[model samples]
Target: MISSISTNQIKYVLALEKTGSFSEAADLCFVTQSTLSIMIKKLENQCNLILFDRKSKPITLTKEGEELINQLKLIYQEFEVLQEIIQGTNQEFYGNLRIGIIPTLAPFLLPLFLNKLVTNYPNINFSIDEITTQEITKRIKTRELDIGILSLPIEDQELIQTSLFNESFLIYDASGTFSRNKKYKIKDIDVSRLWLLEESHCLSSQIEKICLLKKMDTSKHNLEFKSGSILSLLELVNMNKGLTLLPKLATLQKNLIKPSYIFNLVNPIPAREIGIITHPNFSKKRLLDILEIEIKKSVKPLLDKTKRIQLINPY
Candidate 1:
């Protein structure tokens, strides 16, 4: 009888991808180099394909090998879920809960709720990844991440979003150019002096859209700077005498500048709907409910909420 691909063989391939060298992969898989190579060769023979480019120094995956590895990842995930299902039937959310949070939210939000979350659920093991919104969505779909805290309208039909809060943008000035007004107009502001996070961050894209700066050619400007860290931008704003917009939660953090410099956007105030996103098939109902309640308790009191805030459409 023809044998099926073994889980150990699949693991060897994944380890090789991570390590890039067979010796390192063998060390990780706790086997001799010959043993690991033999197992992979067996898998290749069973499938009748060359899984690796033997001519390459560290060995890159062949086109067919890449496709096969993707399927292997799915199979491995299913095996884990099957085990979780059996164990979860009797336990009460005591195992590791994998979570991903966007860069914009992780710094400000974690400080507010992480301590309380750990104190209350001491038994619950938590592993969190600070990543981009797009990455979070991809990982959740593949069952790599259980939950994500990010600005919403993920727009993926496979994911379920639960609104947690609405965070409005606040204009923080250090350039000494912006005057204190109840309302600020985007056009009136100097786009040249505007400091923004890098394009990889969803928040920066949201700001670009709302301000009608979609085609804003920053290259012509005498100075160009893009940062991924809000805290870094805040420091640069103060040092370089520049200006930037900040999310409500970020403004509440440690700031060298005074509050008198902060201003709000006028009618139809621009905001991003912050929410928890999970796979539709994720079976962590009790855990999700508890986390939602805890997060709301920590954040709601600090937020200056209003019906006037408009969620920017993520196009």
Candidate 2:
């Protein structure tokens, strides 16, 4: 009976599970609400179990239904893998590649290689999202995302990580508080006048660690502000006479911020290791190789080749 279930039926069920609404799921699956409902009911009848609680307002799966959906997702992923395998055998890269990048890296990093990738691989379909580190790892593990580009080292042992490049951190002092001619050490930073992204961002945490923000006294400032965007952070810094740490890539856009406002860190410069992460069983090696090559080529010339560097952990 299980063998009799069609791929379309599986897709219907998965879509319903994801959207938690018959109408929304129907739209996602490109089917009528009635058709989706009938297919799911049929699937449930065949198994002699009620998969969804129809009485529930947005619809919810039962305990047994949850277990069944878990297995169904695995089966669906395997089907995708089989398709990828066939495409790989043809020696042609033509398939969907779902990519998630952390917000801190997404803005600065995507601009470096996205256009080249899209132009070079016209056959590949790229779906990219700016997601947090935790969400990226979760989606990759669930086979929802093909790859993640973010700062390492992630604690997940199930994922395979490939180091892409080391991006150094620089001080963006809009108030001209720090000397432009000299490299500033972490100890020279005044936490009271420092602004940062909200604590949720990994970049914010990395900055905190590098500057020892937790240990410093920030109570002197009457107004406390934190932003989710580097661009916003820069704006606030400029308006309020505050400073924030920015990744090297963020400072490269000369039109966005003046060269006089950007300052370098002292010797043994703090940097973050950016990398691509994927599940252990991820296929499409050729696609990954090309992506890595293009990204490295784009950023190699932009990044400083100096040997004095210290890698900051994102965790």
Best TM-score goes to which candidate?
2
Clashes of each: 0, 0
lDDT of 2 by residue, 194-302 (tens): 8777777889889888986664344666667666777888888888888888899989888887888888896789999999999999998889998899999999999
Q: List the residue pairs that clash in candidate 1.
A: none
- Candidate 2 deviant stretches above 4 angstroms: 1-91, 215-221, 224-226
Tens-digit lDDT track of model 1 for 1-315: 337767788899888877778999999999999999999898888888888887787778999889788888888888889878866653555877899999988988888888877766667888899999989999999999999999888889779999898998878888777776446766666777777787889888887877779755667446566778887878777777767788888878755447866877767778888889999998878899888888888999988868888787544
Cα RMSD (Å) per model?
19.6, 18.7
Which ranges in model 1 have alpha carbons more than 4 Å from their true place?
Answer: 1-91, 224-226
